[model samples]
Target: MASTDNALKTASVLAFERKLDPSDGLFHAGNWDGRDDTTAWKPVTLREKSVRGTISNRLKTKDQDPAKLDAAIENPNLQTVDVATLPADADTLRVGFTLRILGGTGRPSACNNAAYQTKLLSTVQGYVDANGFGELGRRYAHNLANARFLWRNRIGAEQVEVRIQHLEKGQPKTSWTFDALQLSLRDFQTPNGVEKDINSLADVITTGLAGKGHVLLQVTAFARIGAGQEVYPSQELILDKATSKKSKTLYDVQGIAGIHSQKLGNALRTIDTWHSEADTLGPIAVEPYGSVTTLGKACRKPTDKLDFYNLLDGWLLKDKAPPPDQQHFVMAILVRGGVFGEAGKD
Candidate 1:
């Protein structure tokens, strides 16, 4: 696979001390009076804890691997792995992992689940807890000794390898296990310069597409990549008879077609109108109309046009906003909404 300039490879280690049962591995919320010797405070204890594992990547690859380089070439799909991890609250903890192709290199088409390394080394999280009656104090322990990664290769050969060893004291040398393992890749841009590493990009498109000015796209989102650039939908379009045979109505459609209401459409339009007005008005000082207030106290109170822009800019840009001017960028987008201006002060 041809790697992207932003591919990153890293490992995360998490540790949770063991907890006692009955509380089911959670610390109770109520506060007790330590001064009241008359009352007994059910001594809350920690017996077991868990760590989540993740691996992310953003590598590019060509449609066909070079025959000469196939042996040594490691594609993003080849490195993505998924393993189960134990949950602290439940008797059985399960962890899920997946690999994704952020972009493509030589190949015009994108990559999927087939290219990852077949060998995955994962172990169930387990530990022993003993206090000798709580006076000497209890201990939740597990050693990392002999932890291994196991997976199969494309040729169907089973591969098992050790990654950590000796996790706990006074336990069987082979008793250590892991809950889950994940791998992801992405580019890392820094202030000193662009330092691209293999790290997994967030599934921001699916998770945050419902908000204003954002649309879910399949091809175009992957196509735009350059220095100091942002990801955005090429355009927004509604389905019509020529496009979708269902002939669903919009803004006031029926049944499944009408899942979104006219009230919402009008609200969206109002938001759009405000943004458009802001471009010329500079800023607004009026209370917002429609459902803007429903966002609750978490919404920023814009005192100027820039304030309004700053508020919605994060939502406009799916990924993290660039620093220094990020706030300025945010204010600028909101300013387009025509909702606020420089004269407004609240």
Candidate 2:
């Protein structure tokens, strides 16, 4: 139990407005430069195939015919298709969102909670001044530049392209293409090595944070699910309603896959929640007499309550606060987790 006196009482949410249109784009990977190509947005279709099994003692016990089994085996069996390519005319998804510090500069009322405001305000402002929302920018850039927004990216997606149109004073419309599988977290670094695209994205975010403009980002994703030699789990594995056994159909076995626009919208919501690394401190339990520690070593007693700002303050004091990117990532997640409002009070 952690003490409530030092708890975090306020936070800001970085919500984005989003839209998905599956039918808008030519569905293919190779036509990225606005060229007409046949490979773009190709639909994946699955054809049913027969299953072959060998006759055995179990079949004999069931009075199954071995001759029929042999005949079935002799016929040409359909090859298994584990993944599918998405067809053109598939709905293309579009997400519209902005990133900004909710309570900074012109939005003092954003952090209206009286208890923690005085203490945390200066720190937050200092962070804004130095980092210019770099952490939030970096994460957003990574999500787009890496195609982390593509649900099928976990499978095999050749390309994930993001076309950005910024409505700002000095910036022009820009677009970037990324190899979905090749983008990594390290690409968001300040110097960012040879990846000029990521660096440009970082600059865009910095401009947004500086109040120069808002970003309009449209993402187009193209993926091939079941084409290669690898076998993947079919989408049709379900419990049989009649037999209550695991069942599948040939339709489930093979085909191309495309993500729905609504699903793409939902994926973007993931940024709202924070995911922190596991706590290094061992667990602490409180008993009627005293405290028990997971390590079985001498330790301080547990507090009654705990929250993000408290931990952040402690870390800042100890010079152990995470880097700006990590901090922004955690904050976004915390906002999505609903850890703000009066309930966040210490």
Candidate 3:
């Protein structure tokens, strides 16, 4: 039997503020008002038309099976032709967003392990301070240059150019140019050959939507097999208008098993932190003016709950390193559901 510890799980909360087309339920970047300044970075929603076209082209070319091709084209969820294609303009879809390392519960952000979290933060900061978000930009560049975002990236994409806006306040905007055809043939490899550069496309899309005021994207990753050493995003749900029953047009794509689209009213409730249950750990909870040695079952305040970092610190103090599965679990709970920033909310 597979151990529960090995199960892959992840929790993420991506909030965005942007304008949406009431008629088509499409995202519009130019209409962003920038009302919320809560997070350090914001995401610009890319046109669904572009996303659809890109996906469709890739699918048709790569999959030789006629039935699968038809399914890809006919399925409303997978079909990109329904939306009108717009000309690329000044409002290009920029790829970049600030990824928070701490979850609402002070756990590792995105359910990443302590080691991964430490490396990501330190590496990103080092690059940002020295060269100004260049490493991130390169990753974005590699994605666009290789058309790795396409649903069928292995096949290749036609001429494509992606413009990445700098996350830093004063840095200049830059464009990463690449020929999809050339990138397809190039045998690019990361320092560690275990993972490919193109694999980051999923991360790029999930993070890019952080600022799109309309949609709330929550991703969860957990071990599905073995000792749960490797975690992968098992669920990526989109809370949008198409899935809402109140809307006149229902864009339900049942074939795409896990993509959830719900009305804004229902979606907001998923991440509502105001009325969340307190998740606590440790033998005795810390309380104000409480006796620590008393047997009256000490409890820690919700705000005082230990996050992933703190939990890791506690584990380190014991001279015992957390196993991979435990690390993933700790991080998952931190982001499971609840507002991290609000005091006593989780």
Candidate 4:
């Protein structure tokens, strides 16, 4: 490596905003047949339920004695929790959100080092020219069409349908409907019949990333489970668990049960099959460290030179182009976006 190149350092004020912006998913309940007419659907509301409960949790040795166990069982563990359920007449759960795919991906939101930023942007442009955004765009579109953003709500659904509309102003310009259950979460293979539609959707996303045009999409997913069945919404992270009155707090937007945009984004970007453990673990979300918080382990690590910093620096600073997969990983980190500046030295 050249001395000049070795001397170059990462920007101390580097940051990037997420290119794929999504709004919070608002939940609604309606009959499966009424999916075409969502105007009549009702917003899923939270209901408070109290349960007598039982003492099933692990107890200390002292509390395991026969008399003590009997006494504890008598008291039991009573609690009040918030739950969301589809109305008895409504057999479908509708999740709606708008996604805006912004351009200027490679450009940093903040970068102090002009020289380094220039090289980085140039490298990203080179990638765009050679590969285009087709691969990543296709995967993202697939996630949408598959209704992966529905998360737990899609599980055991009798039928899942996804409708995506290209919005111009307040109206839809073009629309696509998908039988979400036909798509697989494990791979990005074009499902036999939906190939053309997936490709069309992928092209729009690619165009958005390439700065060809602005892309705004309205997405609606219908999951037909059963009437009066429990529907899963995003849970609020209670910082003070002990002091909190309700054990389970469902997320709400003005009294209407909803899912977090972060959770939806996480589901959509679960396209990191480039990591080493992907074959076994399936596709985790595209994160800088390839982190899957639910799994409690990072798929990529700096020690292994598989992390974003290592691969990115190798490409831009070291003048060593990474493999296509690794390149995709680096670009994905940019799409995910973060404040990635190197910390200042003392």
Q: Candidates sorted by lDDT, descending order?
A: 4, 2, 3, 1
- How many pairs of residues in model 1 come into backbone collision? 82
TM-score per model over all chains: 0.16, 0.47, 0.25, 0.95
Off by over 4 Å in 3: 1-82, 85-156, 167-175, 179-319, 322-346
Task: Point out the higher-scoring one by TM-score: 1 or 2.
Answer: 2
lDDT of 4 by residue, 134-181 (tens): 999999999999999999999999999999998988898889999999
Tens-digit lDDT string for candidate 1 (15-91) = 11111111011111111122123232222122222333332433244664666345334422222111222123222
lDDT of 4 at 133: 93
What lDDT tens digits, residue by residue, belong to model 2 across residues 143-252?
55555545434444334445444434545477666555566533333234426776677677656545565544445554333233222222443465474332233222
Best by TM-score: 4
lDDT of each: 0.20, 0.41, 0.28, 0.92
What's every prediction's RMSD, in angstroms?
30.0, 11.4, 19.7, 2.0
- Model 1 regions more than 4 Å off: 1-254, 257-292, 302-306, 309-346
| Per-model tally of clashing residue pairs | 82, 35, 18, 0
lDDT of 3 by residue, 190-249 (tens): 334313433443234223322222222221111011111111111233368586433122
